[model samples]
Target chain A: MRKSTAPIISIADVKNVLGKQVVHEHLNLDIMKGEITAIVGGSGCGKTTLLRNILMLLRPKSGSIKIFDIDILHCDIKTSQKIRHSWGVLFQHGALFSALTVLENVQFPLRTFTTLPPKVQKEIALLKITMSGLPLEAAFKYPSELSGGMLKRAALARAIVMDPELLFLDEPTSGLDPQSAGAFDELLLDLKEGLGLTVVMVTHDLSSLAHVSDKVVFLGEKKVLAALPLQELLKQKHPLIQAYFSGSRGESYVKSA
Target chain B: MNNQQPAQLSFDKNTHTLHCSGSWTVSAISDFLKQPPLTTNKTNRIQIEGGGISRMDTTGAWALHQQANALKKSGKTISFSGFSEEHTALFQMVEAALPEKQPRPKSSRKPSFLYVLGKKSVDRYFSLLNGLAFLGEVIVFFGRIIMRPARLQYKSFLNVIDETGYRAIAIVGLLSFLIGIVLAYQSGQQLKTYGANIYIISLIGIAMLQEFGPLITAIIVAGRTSSAFTAQIGTMQLNEEIDALRTMGVSPVIRLVIPKILGLIISLPLLIILADICGVLGGMLVADKMLNISYYSFLLNFPNMIQLQTLLNGLIKGPFFACIIAGVGCYQGFQVVSSADSVGRKTTKSVVQSIFLIIVADALFSIILPWQSV
Candidate 1:
């Protein structure tokens, strides 16, 4: 995504403290509208923590997070909830509610966030399930019964059920076979085009970074090192960043890009 | 943008044309599908004019595609005009993503009621045999450990003792004291009628040592330790930690199950001993208050009335009860399927099954042993 003057999501001077350790200090980031942005970093670099902060699941020690230009840090509960409805999140390992069937899991957000009748919610959920590349029979199966790939698809269906403008995906292609991962990238790109979603994904899959992400954000040194297009990120001078994009997988990804 | 103008459809009879107008999105789908001006017969050779459409999305596209499919089913020619490039692409994408019909396998034949009954009975029988097989495996594992004492997980055994033993002391003591007081008071009332108030010591001592102490302690442990064991192992199973352990060449039975079994087996007898002492002390207190029997006289008569044989009978039942509780707890843990709800159900089942088995074992012991001989 291009760096637009008006950002759909903005983070400024973010400070995140975990016990005596500091995860992020004076971190600033922006996500443009209708762009697929991938956050990549090494272990212990707090990529997941940043995603959690943006999702409002974790509160930063100090920061200003604005979604749709509204300051979320100081916003009242009702206002914050209203803003939350404009975005959807998919967690790593699909974090699906194991107690609910695929249909119920997809319908969960609509039930909580909308006053729509059950029948309409069901219809929308079924449509989203099909869109997420799941079969009709998968609707009734429990999360426990689903394979890893199917779980991710079911979770994705739930995430997009409300047609939120911003979609947050955490390690979306992790644990999937290469074919399934490639198929998942295609699905992400398809959703971005067809639904005009501004997607923020945290992933380490270089191929996904190459194919799906319009822009890539590299994190190191307790903060974002760079936020640039995938091609530009590859040419970065930072040793860690260079090493990250120099692996065999990275070479394949660059060739594909 | 006008509300009346939105979703308005006009069919020209002369041209056989359908004019679509307004917001043809998710919100307008109900109205568009429920009230279409084009009749089923008139839809033949249908021409959809999309120029009047103010907005359309994937949902709208899907709805229109479904309508087109219906028209095709009726042998009608359909065409869309004035749809923007974006809308056209989205429509085609959604149409391509539609789920394909799959053929479900049919059951060859419905089983007769007798067959179902026989099948259920066979399943139940196999499950019983499976439980026996599990017991055999546990016994074999125990024998192997006995032959090689160095293989025991001492740290895990100690941890289980801390959890199921030391932590359980307070509740076991409290319940045993209360049971003793109830027993002493109730028996003392009837014995007073016969001027045999001193016999209250014998009643409470014999009952506590031979029956209530071990039985009550086992039941409490079943509710406490059994449920904990099931939930802990069941959650580990759900998280694939067991699979991880297996891949690392760790025997779950030796590393996980045996330690728990050893902990409960060692702790239960010690708990029963504490319970017996507390119970006897409680009876003495109640005997002094309710029966006007002095504590001095109660202590003097207690050993004479409660024989070593009587105390030994209850203590002997401890390890058996422990085995049942621990075995049932771990067995139910293994039975847990994937999901958080299964953990809760298996925990409940563990407690229920352990207590049931303990009671059954105690009953058999009582029937075979001579309690009346004391």
Candidate 2:
């Protein structure tokens, strides 16, 4: 998590455009190995778009994204598999396969990528399922059958089932009630400490941003305005950052800190 | 340092311990579990040595835990020694995260075959009753709209008619015309063999106007527009759009279903008339080409050969077939459960059920209708 450590992911001078509208220009960011870095921004600031760029769901119009020292934007599908094997992604909508049960969803990557026997695979998947705070009985349930909080937990279990060193989360706690959201933040910290994972998440929840992230990347003006710890970034004099954290709902957390 | 030394495991048989060195990480697990540690019968306790380990992931730690569990099951006590604090914590975490054995209340006895048969038959009967209940709901909604007049959805009515009506014209006409040509050619050949080629006019007219035109048009609509209705409403149901309408104080049955029923009723009879015209033209073309019947002679004999009642009987089936098609499609759409898989299944059921009902209705008309005098 230290600044001196080599970055697990680095983006240099990226430009992202969608249909003549520029989302991000000259965007540069770094995610150090073994840190929880969060991308937080206003509604249309393209936080999810930036996450997609790194995940290679959408490649930026220009610039480079490197994860585990591999230049992902220019890599072939075969080369990308190496990065894919080392990291797991949780989509905003809990994009768990609707057709598969939660246990089968967790076991999918291990069955496809690892040569471990099936019995061991089930053991590891169950471990992750319990670790993510889902009851084991819920494992056989379909995605549609799960509540919003349960859906996120199920997706988290599947994401970490492979024990990847790098994890990317897009709005991991967006739709849940406050109690569940706090529980999810605690779960995130636990996973980060337990697995020694380097996490990069896109979220707007101020409480989670203040509590969980080792570093916060504030996106604004189509670029990263500040990539600092939450307290340090909050002290900046910029009108946009000031207005963002000054809102009635988000203010108490800042004042409480 | 992510890639450290390859893992090493050694059994110190004299000390009753397993010595592990180098990186015990995820990549090494598949091979690591293959070589289980060896212990002699004299040893009552097993110790796993982890001091010399260079790296470890949760996977490596979990796999090692499984090995330790296996040793414990074999009447040997298991313990870990010389692990770095981080590695020890990770090992403990993996140990703590293991799923608890839960006692779910599962049904102990399987149902008998006779029970299953009885249940299936009851389910089928309920589904039939459900269909009639759906029809009752539609008729109630239809009556309400008729009484209120202002409650009718003109926009959706126009949209539905445009979709299942104007858009369907080309395919219906093409198929009807092709049937007409085949009917004319086959029957005219027989009439020519008997030197009664002019009778081909009566044969082609009766078949196209009295039976084939409405049946063919209905079958095509069953396959095309009916399936579309099912998929459209099924997807809406999946998206909770129907729920959204309900929360807004809108009646989903009136807003979604009734307009389709009305639109199809009005559009189908018009389409049946168009089908009849296309069929007659195709018959005339084939008659002139194959049997040497001139257009002028065909036109002169057409009214005498086929009466207006023949066309009217076929058109009468149009509204009935349309009602069945729309009713079945919308009903199946409402049956779509939460999953996307259900949408596909319901759409298939919609088409099959529509065609089946259409054919049954057609058979009734064939048997009991006063077509013989006409």
CAPRI grade, predicted model 2: medium
Candidate 2: the clashing residue pairs are: none
What is the C-alpha lDDT profile of model 2 across B245-270, one tens digit per residue?
Answer: 99999988999999999999999888
Q: Write the per-residue lDDT of candidate 1 for residues B87-189, one digit (tens) a residue.
A: 6777887788765653232455888999999999999999899789878989999999989989999999999888888999999999999999989988888
Top candidate by lDDT = 2
- The CA lDDT at B191 in model 1 is 93
Model 1 off-target regions past 4 Å?
A1-4, A110-124, B1-57, B64-84, B100-112
Measured against the true structure, the TM-scores of the candidates, in listed sequence, are 0.89, 0.91
Q: How many angstroms is the interface RMSD of candidate 2?
A: 2.8
Candidate 1's TM-score:
0.89
